[model samples]
Target: MTLRPISEDDIQALVDERLDTARRSEVEAYLAANPDARTRVDRLRTLGRDLRTAFAPIATEPVPAQLNLAHIVEARRRPRLQVSAWQAAAAAILLALGGLGGWGLHGTLAPAGVDALAQEASANFAVYAPDRTRPVELAASDSAELARWFSARLDRKVGVPDLRSADCRLMGGRLVATPHGPAGLLMYDDHRGTRFVVLMRPMAEPGDAPMREHRFGSATGYAWAQDGLGYSLVGAADPAVLHPLANTIRRTTATNT
Candidate 1:
């Protein structure tokens, strides 16, 4: 019997472990013959695992009383006979307090260059990490093309760093718009199935730290500046896990540039 040619969706399904018994075997056979597809599939599986691990604590934590939507709706349904001026003022004060409380729930209130980059990188990681189907706009097979495209878009010579030495394999990358201009985002995953992202943009100031660690909420990252370019390695993994990867990326990027 002739086996059908595998599509991108099939590879994604394999990564997600959604394929059936027969299909799984077929995909495994196909991947065994295609080293590139096998590598991409491995990265996708790693990303899925990392995403689950990172968000698992939130899943197990009890919902905040203020954030319980059902309870809030039920409370709203209770009748208020009348709103006196004093009661109105008290209500307004409570509303402001609620807003402040919500703001404080997201950790790290300070503003700085590294902090801003870390926030953006973390946001991007949240968006793309769990998506095994299409996390990157460019394929790893076209690394050279992606390099030229991103360099032109950013008006600088930036190439994708080879992170295999750090046991993290590059899946692909995507281009995004930032306040400074175009930024490049590259995705990678390690052997243990932890996902990480690297974001690069043009630096605004001349003097910035070569490397800085940042943490906000459950996110941990490292941001740095070199050669007038700002770089960040962001993920939901712990700081200990990300620090070494950040160093590896820094050295690789410096050499590539």
Candidate 2:
């Protein structure tokens, strides 16, 4: 039988492995003649392998029974004051020492929220990144399809800008939950290791004015908001390596919007 032209739905179905033997063979033959489609197939295959390996260990673990009943009664109980007297005394001493500069002292002592975000991004990157086969929900080779898949899941349009011209290649993207809402995790790699950028719609009130730069451990981050979207770029790379990519992303997003 002669092969039919591949539609977007057909490609998706093939990726989902819904095709029968004959149709699968037809698609394989078609992919043999199309390099881009072949690359996409290979990438998806890799992702399947990675996902299997990443999740296989969980299947063998036993579930605990007491974990459910112990928490059920606690939910209906009244709130308890758990603060110790010693803890309150220490807080009083600190407040007295801080005196009129308490606000400044608090600012200096408080953990930076941006740093927390960067650390979470990096830890997630490290865990999910080893899957060279399927590191993202949408591969770079399938930008349009990925955009469609992610946009629908996130309830907003998502775009993947090509940075290969700037010597960076798309590593893939994953869906992650954030305090604001569900966020898209798009990663890229250059000569060094992986760099991550998170895309999401802005929260009703992000609390403070816009923060441009944040440093956490060895990672650095940049955040900005425009056109009802929030963009955050984080990586262990220096400002020199990241600045250009940040500019490229900002420019591309700005132009397209």
Candidate 3:
């Protein structure tokens, strides 16, 4: 019996596992006629396997003690007192003095470069976090399209990290203006209903390490570079969750290169 030709949608659905049992069978039958389709599937499967092997080790690590749930709950319940203008000015003065003192200490103090980057990242997150409409230029449901679109906008190749294993789903992306011109924002959500991570990178700057972590406010973020592109992971998830995701991103991205 002659098999029906496989449609692009069929191949895509198979890639995404959205095909039903009968449709899956049909796709397999079609592949028997077209070995090229099988080759593509095999390549994708191998890529996924490599990513899993390289990064899954991080998932086994113990959660950090600093991520105590009780502390987070207590912190949420604490009163958020508003400071008066005079009080704000006084606090600013104190901060300036502290900064100057730290600067005087020089080598004794860690450089504020990372801290500045964290503040910048936090500020960027704050601006978009409350945005309910058009938070992302591309939706997570269209991650492949997003990857292509962002790659063009940033003038570098970009890829979305698969988070299903980590129990998260993509939440779309937005383009935001930054000190370095335009940037991309890709958000994700885990089972907790909490928005987990925001991956951001300069639309222009290129060349950096595979990963860097920054602590901003009460949150920690991981950023990285791979294949001549930059990436940043910002979220409230525990380091245990975020770190593995970062490793996966690094591995997947490196493989693609």
Candidate 4:
């Protein structure tokens, strides 16, 4: 019997475990013959699994009392008889607080240099990590092309880090914009399905900087600068475990540059 051609979406579905049972065997057979696609699917599965594990706690948390619908409606109707100046002020304050809460998510306020790099990596991880279908535009088998892509976009000689020694396989990468400029975001995963990201962008000025660990809500990342480039490796893992992995990236990047 003739079989249907496998598309990128099919591979994504296989990795996400969302492929139809009838097509599951067919896709497995195809991946068995295609090493690159097989590898990409494995890493993507890891990324999705890790994303769920990391965000499950936050997903289960109850909504804050201040954000409760009943509370807001009650407050609005509390002064039906006559809205006093203090009541009006309180309403305005609640609105102001809501706006302030979102400022960080929108990157309206961020730290300078390395911290910003880490924060951006963490933020990007939150976005792409959860996306099982299209976490990245390019796959790890295209590392050479990925390297050239990042190099041209950043206007620097950027190279893809080889994390095989660290047991973190490169899944893929895509270009992400930062307040500073365009940044390259690479995703990776380990055997245990632990996923992480590495973000690199050219610094405004060239100077060596010490490695710093940053925690962005539930995400943890390590950021540093060497030569003229800034790099951040972020994941949902703890700082101690990620420390060595970040070092591995540092050495790989240094050698590649």
Q: What is the TM-score of each candidate against the true structure?
A: 0.56, 0.50, 0.49, 0.59
Worst 10 residues of 1 by lDDT: 99-108
lDDT, candidate 4, 163-220, per-residue tens: 9988889999999877677899999988987889999998877987889998877778
**Which candidate number has the best TM-score?**
4
lDDT of each: 0.78, 0.64, 0.65, 0.85
Per-residue error (Å), model 1, residue 76:
40
Cα misplacement distance, residue 224 of candidate 2 (Å):
1.3
Give stretches of model 3 more than 4 Å off: 1-120, 130-134, 202-206
Q: Write the per-residue lDDT of candidate 1 for residues 63-168, one digit (tens) a residue.
A: 8889889987877666443446558976665454333222232333334576666656766777777788899888788889888988998898998999888788
- The per-residue C-alpha lDDT of model 1 at residue 68 equals 88
Clashing pairs in 3: 136-173, 136-174, 137-173, 137-174
Backbone collision tally, model 2? 3
- Residue-wise lDDT of candidate 2 within 1-257, one digit each (tens)? 55588776766678889999888888878888999988988898789889999999898788566556666567534333234555687677556434312123343543334433443454445545556667677777777776776688767677777777778788778777643456677878876656565544444444433537766557667765556566677777788877777777777777764
Best by lDDT: 4
**Runs in model 4 lying further than 4 Å from the true structure:** 1-109
Model 1 spans with C-alpha error above 4 angstroms = 1-112
In the range 130-157, model 3's lDDT, one tens digit per residue, is 5688556678878888777777877767
